[model samples]
Target chain A: MSLDKSVVNVSFLEVKVWRGKDDGELVSYQVPGRENQTVLDVVSEIQRSHEPSLAYRYACRVGVCGSCAMTVNGMPKWTCRTHVKKVMDDGVLTIEPLRNLPRIKDLVCDLSPFIDTWQQAGAPFCGTKTRHEAPANIDPESKARKAADAGLQCINCAVCYSACDVVSWNKDYIGPAGLNRAWTLVNDARHGERQSTFDKAFGSGGCGSCHSQGNCTRHCPIGLSPSESIAGLKKSALFGLPKV
Target chain B: MERSLFLTQRLTAMALGPLVLVHLGLILFAVKGGLTAEEILLRTQGSVGWALFYGAFVVMASIHGPIGLRNVLREWTDLTTGLINFVTAGFGFLLLFVGIRAVLAVTQTATQISG
Candidate 1:
């Protein structure tokens, strides 16, 4: 007897995917399960075979791009790296867009508000040197450089923003990710607008607004601690206060 | 105002941490010893140590409570930040006045007991 070797044996996985805009509902779909399937893979399978209209964002499937962040089960996670076997409960998965941001469509949240907060926090780097001047050689062993390195891994994933309770409550809050960026700039010796950055950081809806709830640090995929960064900003605010 | 208030809150919190433990420890000691109010007052009467201890507690609480309330009001209500600051600043002053007066009243009564 000849065995049917061409057929692939696949088990089905139950997946609950969020559908529609902000007012949308979760739609359940049965997807073919494979070994080492990631949450992103499950999403792709569902999008490829069952529903072609499902919308999600991702790049660098190896987890470096940091764009595939979504709420898995109840926590924000980098979908590309979150394996289905690890997060699935009773062989079921719940996938939704990141929280605390406006959902643009199915599994997609508009990141404008999150990105705009960077500007509000004065996170832009301003350098004083012209092309004619030699480059500023910053010592890696310097205290400020070490401080900047502590929070320099953020990829604008918005996971910290979604995780922050302050962001949800205060519409004006700069949020963790933004303030964390400003913190790096504050410690950079090459940054020209240190005072202005400190001004914005110490301003209303800035670092002072963070209650140190630690949600940002807790949810960051890169393990950067924004809570500590905010605490540092709170301490630095004393220097900025005399001007106010 | 936000920056100053944040700094004050942190400063007061640091002060309160130790003060609260001392206050609690004193209360526990008094309770365990079954000391009555009169007995406790007698112990505190004309004691500069007790006066300074309670004085710091009242001052720290006055600063800490209002700043905490400011954060709560901002989170729980739609009140503008300016209005919230105005109210919380007023509350802070009220707390300081009331707290200091209470401290003074207790200390004065203790002084009378000694005199």
Candidate 2:
């Protein structure tokens, strides 16, 4: 039997992508939009066909990499998972590099500041696991694991950074994603860096700075709740810990 | 001071949510019945009930607004928090004095308003 041919017609989609370095402008490019076309597909198509000068960054073309996040239609989204039908309006799409970060080139943002904030927020998993590390059994339903699971899905995408009004207002604020990351490490069983992490996470312009506008949670691609993590941090901050 | 003030602000806000609804309902009922400002004033001008209601309102509001303003000053201005707290506390007392004066003008005994 011959293949049951059902060829889906690909159409040229007009995507208005932000171009240039920090001092950039919005430039238009048309790309092939297939049946299940993602935002990254259009960008890559632009690079392949129309504009060789267009610069953007992405490694794995799936949601796993988390490298391809941008502001789509006035909202932050993981471009790899964001389909054309979800964001395209009247055949016009406005794509911008993520906000609250420096733009290195067209559609590609420098994540150094975002990653640095994670470090500053004390998000590293410092192990208390020694050279004589034994197989430590953790109950799946344990309080720490349950708490950590909610926040551990962060792909370090700066979509939360772009969505955070607090970060926009107070540049010193570590923001939702960073704070969420810190929350995960706080629940980590083997992390030796918990106390120091808690200290930095509770300081001025840290968790206290978040007004819980629900932006980070609202715009998150994976249904993660940064707002809840921030609330948890605030509750922890109000404890018997000595204040400076 | 910060913690206590924050707690008071939340408490007052909880109080005001209902008070505001009641105030709005009163206004709406009066407007619906075609009651003039003069007629409303005549009812409230000497009533102890009106005075007590307004007195409680003034106290709660005076407690809340200044604390909220202190945070606003700290966030928006170059003012030191100590300075902000001092200025806001002074303003709260000023609001209390004026509010109390108004309440006394309407709610106190005949001799109190006249004197």
Candidate 3:
């Protein structure tokens, strides 16, 4: 026999993607695939070629926007950042909407709770500067700025919330992304609302409840580690504060 | 209940942090050095320090594992009642017994080791 052998070039996918209106049925999808294809690519292919009825959301194809995050193969992930070969072994893929939220329709989980929880996490940047005044200068190398920068890249994907086991169990718990956001705001030097943000994220179903299981870090497609951020928060709560 | 649990978990974790790391480091060093069991016992025999260290490790582990398992059962499994506590307590006692026996053997002098 010759030492050289030919390789197979085929595009086939068997995706068990959830389908229907709210409170709907699970449906299977079989679509064409290619090497280096993403889960979002598959959904888009299905929408464009096979079934025009599929619904999903995405603003940027890259991981930067965090808009195209979805549950791929049982883990919440940014679909845009995920490759088919990495997740879809055995030619099988199961696509589901993000968990711990209302499902608006097939493949689209409602993001209203995520936003609401962001507020619950106290993530808004509140400064005294008015619209007419010159912008206050913030030092990039400052400790506060670096701490804030640690969590500022989050795109509000809800991937952390969906990937969080704590959020699923304790519904009151503001998930990792929200807590991570709160941490950044807490670290903002311009923000006078630091104490309030701390108060919001420190109690029951809060930063203390995290078991440091690191599921959020494991699943984050953007490489932001919310577990570290949460740990930082816990440290502040426990030891860094001056005695009251 | 919350305060006690948090305190206990923290205390155990604090104790375990160094103990587990030291334990792992010792296992690695011993196995890599190809040290025999007799050589290992030679150092440990009649050593109160080793007994205390191992005793603290076992006690901390007994406190840590059941609390962790308790949370897991509460979250993942539906088993709850006095029975869960009874089982957890029983497990802790078993760990204490086995752990103490190992510590005692290591603490015994050379004559006691062979005896």
The per-candidate count of clashes, in order, stands at 0, 0, 0
Rank order (by lDDT, best first): 1, 2, 3
The TM-scores, chain A only, for the candidates as listed are 0.92, 0.90, 0.88
For residues A1-244, write the lDDT of model 2, one tens digit per residue: 6742332365667789888877888888776667777888888888888888888878787787889898887888899889989899888888888888888888888888888788888987887667798855777688767777888878888899989887776667788888998887777766777788877787655776678799999998888998988777666644522221
| Residues B1-115 of candidate 3: C-alpha lDDT, one tens digit per residue | 4234444777789889999999999899888768797978877888888988998998899888876665565546556646666777788888888888988887789788677
TM-scores for all predictions? 0.88, 0.73, 0.66
Which sections of candidate 1 miss by over 4 Å?
A: A1-7, A238-244, B31-33, B44-49, B109-115
Q: Which ten residues in a row have the lowest lDDT in candidate 3 chain A?
A: A2-11
TM-score-wise, the better of 1 and 2 is: 1
State which docking tier applies to candidate 3.
incorrect
Docking class of 1: medium
Which one is best on DockQ? 1
Q: For every candidate structure, what is the RMSD over all alpha carbons to the true structure, in angstroms?
A: 3.7, 5.5, 9.2
Give the B-chain TM-score of model 3. 0.86
lDDT string for model 3 (A30-116, tens) is 776776788898889878877788889898898777778888888898899788889985888988889888887788878988888
**Distance (Å) between predicted and true CA of B72, model 3?**
8.8
The sequence of per-residue lDDT tens digits that candidate 1 reaches over residues B5-113 is 8888888899999999988988898888686878777777667788788889888888899889988898889998789989988998898888877766666664474
